[model samples]
Target: MTEENFLLSRVKRFVGSLAHCRLLGVTVVSAEPNSLCLELPYSEAIVGNPDTGVIHGGAITTLMDTACGSVVICALEDFELCPTLDLRVDYMRPARPGEPVQARAHLFRQTQSILFARCEAVQGERTVAHCSATFMRIGKDASPKAYRDYITSGTAMENS
Candidate 1:
């Protein structure tokens, strides 16, 4: 695979297999060296209002947060744990009742101990929300090895 394709594939697998993402059905739509797009499919399980079929705000929040974190992984030369310090989200409008939401995040800044990012969540032509986030860069060894190993080996192992 080309370098970009390789990173994108690894990022997709690594993020898609997260427990929350698995439960929410979030999938990586695209990824680059410093940006990523993630999609959260519409489903009854995530609906906040049964009458309207609107997805919960918390679900969109997770989608944006995950997108930024995935961008951090894409932006870094080596993988590490970058936990969110703060995430500020501004809602533009409720998502369209039955459409999937797509969130795209871009890395704006990176430092030795921090990373800054911003993202927008949209459903087709309508904006759902925007988010600005800060993450603390814990060193590579500070994270659990399972994710790193899986990304490196392209192998899946049952979690213990």
Candidate 2:
């Protein structure tokens, strides 16, 4: 695989195995170096305000954070388990009912052990939420064999 394909494969596998992400109905919209886009489809189960029919803010936050982490993975030279160190989401407006929210994350900076990313969630042309996050980039030496195997196997399963 080319470098781009390799990066995407890793991301795909990592995401596929995330039960929470899957439960939230997150879908990979696009992926590339230093960036990733994901979408969360609207569901009644995720509604925070029944009267207004707005999706829960926590759900939107999850989408932004997940996209941010995925972007960090794509930015790295190799795959390693990275966890969120800090994440802050600013809600500009409530997500519209019956519409999917898309989050776009961009890697702004990286150091030896930390990555910084920014993300925005949108519905239509309106910005519903924005976020900034920091992640701890654990080295490959610390990665467990089972997690590595899961990612590899997940990717293979996706292809098949």
lDDT of 1 by residue, 19-132 (tens): 999999899888888888899999888898988888889999989989988898788877787899999999999998778999989999999999999999988777889999
Off by over 4 Å in 1: 155-159
Superposition-based RMSD of candidate 2 using all C-alpha atoms, in angstroms: 3.2
For candidate 1, the per-residue lDDT at 139 reads 91
Q: Judging by lDDT against the true structure, name the best candidate.
A: 1
Please give the range of 10 consecutive residues that has the lowest summed lDDT in model 1.
151-160
lDDT of each: 0.87, 0.84
Please write out the lDDT profile of model 2 over residues 36-139, one tens digit for every residue: 88899999989999999988899998899889988977787666778899999999988889999999999999999889999999987899999999999778
Over 4 Å off, model 2: 1-3, 149-160
